[model samples]
Target: MKLVPLGDRVVLKQVEAEETTASGIVLPGQAQEKPQQAEVIAVGPGGIVNGKEVKMEVEVGNTVIYSKYAGTEVKMDGTDYIIVKQEDILAVIK
Candidate 1:
């Protein structure tokens, strides 16, 4: 199964959060923060949305940073993914 985003939406898979701190301290599940970084899996076709012509700047396989609370989570084939509006994506990693 695959996800195909529509209308300025993007599909992504979250990057794994660190289980240990830089100081070598191990963090438990509850102590780990939700990862804001994700890999673009699918991108929507850019078109007129909200009366504005939007062009998609990100492409598939690009790593991106998004708002911490952005997007809706989906589970498929035991894998997790998130669907967010393009605006919610803060930056694309080079």
Candidate 2:
């Protein structure tokens, strides 16, 4: 399924946390944290501001770093997804 975010919102397909360390230390399933990193798959058009449209800072295809528990959880075609406002987004990771 494909989705487009409404004004100033974005949809991120989460990148999962690695379960093992480089040194070969394995992490328990429950012990692993959800990765706050994500690939920006879809973006909303610029949001309205002061009666004028404000362009969004993040764009589709940008990788971003967000709060660990920032977005609303959603599921699409068996894949987990997150929806967040552009204002809630912290930074676009390099």
Candidate 3:
């Protein structure tokens, strides 16, 4: 099975949190923070949404930064994914 977003929705895969800090201190799983970075897996086609023209600026495989608490989490086929709105995406990494 695959995930396909609709309207202005975007699907992303969260980047893994770092196990160790810059100071070289290893952190436990419970101490790790939620990652704000993600990679685009699937994108919805641009279309009218809420009476506004929604154009998709991001594409598949695009690495992006998003709001901390932006998307809904889901597990599909043992793979994790996040479903968010295009607006929730802050910027695409070059």
Give the CA lDDT, 0 to 100, for residue 4 in model 3: 90
Expressed as tens digits, the lDDT of each residue in 2-84 for candidate 1 is 98888999999987766565743232332333337789999999899888999999999998887646689999999999999
Q: Which tens-of-lDDT digit does each residue in 1-94 have in candidate 2?
A: 6988888778988766565656432323333343367788898886685566868888888878765455798898998888987766777777
Worst 10 residues of 3 by lDDT: 24-33
Instruction: Give each prediction's root-mean-square deviation over alpha carbons.
Output: 4.6, 5.1, 4.7
Which is superior by TM-score, 1 or 2? Answer: 1
Report the C-alpha displacement of residue 86, candidate 2, in angstroms: 0.7
TM-score of model 3 (CA atoms): 0.79
TM-score of each: 0.79, 0.71, 0.79
Q: Give the number of colliding residue pairs in candidate 3.
A: 0
Q: Stretches of candidate 2 above 4 Å error? A: 19-35, 49-52, 68-70
Global CA lDDT computed for model 3: 0.82
Candidate 3: clashing pairs of residues = none
Instruction: Answer with 2 or 3, whichever has the higher TM-score.
Output: 3
**Which 10 successive residues of model 1 have the least lDDT summed?**
24-33
